[model samples]
Target: MYDHRKLGRELNLFDTDPLIGAGLPYWLPDGALIRHILEEYIRSVERQAGYRHVYSPVLGKRELYEISGHWSHYSDDMFPPMDLGNEQVVLRPSLCPHHAVMYRSRSHSYRELPLRMAELGGMYRSELSGVLGGLTRVRAIHLNDAHIFCTLDQVADEAQAALEMIRRAYEALGITPTRYRLSLPGPGGKYVADAEKWQRSTALLTDVLERFGLAFEAAEGEAAFYGPKIDVQVTDGAGRESTLSTIQVDFHQPEQFDLHYIGADGAKHRPVMVHRSIIGSVERAVAHLIEQHGGAFPAWLAPTQLAILPISDAELPNAAALARRCAELGLRAEIISAERGSLGARIREVRQVPYQAVIGAKEAADHYVSLRLRDGRRLDPQPDGDVLARIRAFVDAHGTALWDNAARHCPERKS
Candidate 1:
């Protein structure tokens, strides 16, 4: 396991300063790379699943949460509201309610029953000061949040599709099946009072889990206030359980929000809402990555993929040129050519980088460079073109590790 504080400093990922209040984090350039890369992967997965992406404001009128019952059930976890000329606005604690409003943006029909909406929306919540932790539990979070509007009859199939997606993500992350629990709620639970609806939903989820031959642990009443859900829980290096993903079936929201569409019989029908997150929060996932990989990120996700070290100042120009070519190939590159340190010390610093390109007089004479691997293997780099191709292929191999487990398993193939 990695010490988050030490790794954060070593990599310059983030820092907690007196000016940056507790529960709030400031991402450095390196940290932003991880964040943005994660968002891109989530977007790709959503697009593959036929989800229409949407953006919602960071704050909304107080009534939005109130209508979604967040005001009553989760008000304590919310940032206080601001009073603006008799209008009350609050930082959004969740994106589900906003997505609910979007479902009503246009009149929909049975033909559009399963309308999947996805977003990587930023959100804020006010957790107790004592409960806050770096990345794992932060006040600001970006969620791979999504909601699927399906007819009552389509709920089972949609939820199954979501489960499959979740499974694929976990597997790709090298998360062993035993590390997570796919939990569902039971009938007559505190979440919903409708016995028939609860029974049907629970049974549908059970069948899906069994059909996929996926193992899950069912919690009799571990669900959201308005619905039943399947959660992906990971046991941290400290053996503490944390939720990495969630898939909830909301039976009450459609009625509460008055969401409707024309049925086959031309009658009004309510659409079931499936709320899900492949990686519950980007912050938490990064925290997990740190601990899981022990701060030695895989080649693809490393902030600085290759650090170029020119042994002599005379080779600086050549090293710089090679760095530029690597950058053009989409590989993050760093060059160090100062004589303040010995060659051994310079090479030792190679540990800070997952890959290294070493330039020296001998290499320049031979028209080759020394390539250092994370595992201590050294290969002489060939021509610039060959080096670029090798680096590209190495990146391609490591890029798979950067994906959500699901997409990693069922990689997107070109049509």
Candidate 2:
């Protein structure tokens, strides 16, 4: 029964002002901080897994989509053309074509067969206004987008490695959903123009999944226009299911884009293409996070990790100094000026922030801070560094701003 709109408003995450067109989100400072944390999380995971960060254009020439078959299958979702001097440009619907352009920038040898490129690419899509819902569905969104180019022989290991990274991501986000799906696009629906290639690619993916012991359901016609995909789905709190991650197999795109790699055989070979988003789209994931956690974020992901409340104006400076120390240790902290309201009212406000540090004149004078845990465990007065260390340890263990006292608070599951 957690209303996302109300929570979003109260938390200052984002809003849809009537003045701004619908489905276009304007993230407030708090929301932007969360976005940075998410992006950094993905980037850190990707880099450790050998992905090179890349930047691709927000729009591309019409020829790019025409080559990739998006112009025919998904043109309606694209923003209308922009006349760029002599060329007609359309906003990129996906990151594959641009990634292909990156591949073609240089001739890669067999040693570089599995070149992984990742981007936090912002994209624009003209969605029907009626279908938009907060961050879950939006016209403009950014993706945790990535593309992998691997030799046909190397596809399985590459795919499995991608899955490992995704698993780490799920753990980091504190999501544990028992049911997972590997969606193979329904053939003959969108991008399977070559029957022989489709059959081989699909079979190759199936074998890869079997060899990896990964279970999946074949989704006939669900494949992207350029390839077949394995979609990762998680059921939300209300028994509604949605995609959380995806790994797509593409053979046609290499041929369509004339991509090539020098193989061990010393000849040109078309490397298989894998498009993956471990966390899917950020907007969609954050929306799902709100739903999954019922708006109670874990410590690591909480926008405001530690809210400080001083008993009176005399203690504000001390609380502010402690908050600064918290920030230096990579924790987000804010101090409520004591004059804003009564100490009890302040504590109520502190609960809304998930974690709070209460400062009284005695505690401030003693150079110790009182911690009010989310689950009602209050530590009387402790050293500032010790309190900060405990908070960091809790956040580190939970990966997000989640309370570690699970015996007290029941953490949500995706289903």
Candidate 3:
């Protein structure tokens, strides 16, 4: 079985320290690069879809969660509040309350109804040490969270769009959902007191699922404290299932925060909140990706996209020039010196790198590079410009294939 915990350490992706406490793993450089790429990709996708990014403090006043009902419904998983002079604050467990406060900061009209706000924000959970395992169950999380404040009639459409967004993200990231789950409130749970709100929220999510023709199983006791949600479930290499994406319809927060927008009739009306996440948490997403691809990530997502290997010390100058060119194209390239080992040994060392450009004596003299792909395919020596452009194109397209005949249109002849 391919466990991320094993691959993560072997690849130097991340590590945990006793001094930092359990359930909190610090990301190494390569792992941080992968995370940064994913974050940038998500932000661009959300921006094109009209989400306004925002930043909120990681700590919130204790009363904030109380008003959002989290304190009453989900405090067992939260850290104890810290005493700060005349007031108390705690690390936020979720971002919805802070967003609700942002919406209430100013009055709005029907035109701005469906205002989408997004954040790659930080939050904390008080998880037991026994339950903590690698990135899958971390105390500190950076969530790809967003909320859409829309009219009651717009909830269904907004939810459908969110689901589609999640699907697109899954395709690009090479993630396959195990199943769709309609998470609902169950008996003996700390659910919101409003039965009517729960019923309405559940119905909204059900309708959305049915309209999408999605086969979903309604799972009880899995709903968030405030509302029911559509959970996109995926299994890891060990066959352990977990939720990676979610879409939820909430009515309680607007009421608790007293959020309103003037309608076309010029009267106050409560806006329904649609909560969604394309990638639930950066840590979990990376963990799954690690197991899914077995540490061989796609070109764009690969930490070191290209490794420049010099066959001998004579080619170091040429290799350095090629590296500079790659940097100019916004590609992450590293030069592995000949002093490390033999050329063959060096190639094996960076087998995880998607592309390797070998600058040998003859190739350096001709100002060309022999391209080596991770899949063991080698292309004949080509000019530096030609090779770099091809790499850039594949990375930009987020392509899975290292060498696509149609997209790249290079000759099949090998070195």
Candidate 4:
């Protein structure tokens, strides 16, 4: 089994300390780089998809979740409230309520229907020690969460689009869903009391799934507290199945928050809330990614995209120059000097790097670099401009191949 906990430690990606508590791990330098790249990629995708990003505080007033119904149904999973003078605040377990409040802050017109708001925000969960492990089950989570406020009529299309976005993101991230699940509230579960709202939300999700021709199972009791959702499930190396992405059509929150938009008919109408997460939580996503690739991430997501190796002291200057050029071209390049070890040893050490640019005495004299790919393929020495251009192209395209000839087209790149 490819366990992220083991691989993460081996690669110096992330770690947990007793003082910081279990369930809360801090990303090492390399891990933080990967996370930053993933975040920027998600933000770019969301921006192109018409989502306006926002930053919301991690703590919310206790009354906020109470109004959103999390206090009534999900308080067990939430941290205890902090008494701040007369007001009490709690670390939010979810981002929807904060987003709902943001929506209600101002009135909206029909033209602004389907206002998509996104945030890569932090939230906390109070998990029992036994249930917490690595990044999968954590106390602090930075979720890739978003909410779309659309009219009731636009619910199906908005949901379908969100599912398509998730598919594209998964393809780019190299994630394969074990199955799609239509998660419904199980009997006796802590769900909203409105049966009609539940039925309506479930039907909308079902219609979207059917229209997309995706085979899914209706699983009772797997839903969010307020609504049913289409869950994209993935299995870890330990054979534990969990949802990595979701799209939920929620009519409950808008009503609870008294959210409204003026319709063309000059009447204030309630807008439905469409909650979507392309990547549910950054920690878990990166954990799965670490295991999926066994820490050899794709070029775009790799902590160090290119490793410039100098065969001897004579080639160190050339290696440094090449590294600087790579940096200017937006590649994360590290120069592994000959002082570290022999060329073979350094090559073995940086095997996870996507591209290895070797600067030997002969190549340095010729102003060329011999390319060694992570897959162990070597190419003839190429000029500096040619090497950097090819590497930049691959990284920019976010493709899965070391070279264009073997590249798999990423759907997200097309968008």
Residue-level lDDT tens digits of model 2 in 1-415 = 4555667767888888878888988888888887888899889889988999999899899999998888888888999989999999998988888999889889999898699999999888899989887887898889998989998888878877877777888887877654556555563445556777767777767776777677777666667776666777876555767777888788877888899989889999888898889998888887777766776677788888888888888898898799889878988898887777987887777674667778887778776777777656765567667778877887777475434454332223122
Among all windows of 10 consecutive residues in model 3, the one with the lowest summed lDDT is: 406-415
Tens digits of per-residue lDDT for model 1 on 39-71?
786788779989999999999999988888888
Q: Please provide, for model 4 over 23-75, each residue's C-alpha lDDT reduced to its tens digit, 9 standing for 90 to 100.
A: 99999999998899999999998999999999899999999999999999999
Model 2 misplaced regions, further than 4 Å? 187-189, 211-214, 396-415
Candidate 3 TM-score, true structure as reference: 0.96
Candidate lDDT values, in order: 0.76, 0.79, 0.93, 0.91
lDDT of 3: 0.93
Worst 10 residues of 4 by lDDT: 406-415
Error of 4 at 25 (Å): 0.7
Instruction: List candidate 3 segments past 4 Å from native.
Output: 407-415
Model 4 scores a C-alpha lDDT of: 0.91
TM-score of each: 0.89, 0.91, 0.96, 0.96
Candidate 1 has its poorest 10 consecutive residues by lDDT at 405-414
RMSD (Cα, Å) for all candidates, in order, is 5.9, 5.3, 1.9, 4.5
- What global local distance difference test value does model 2 have? 0.79
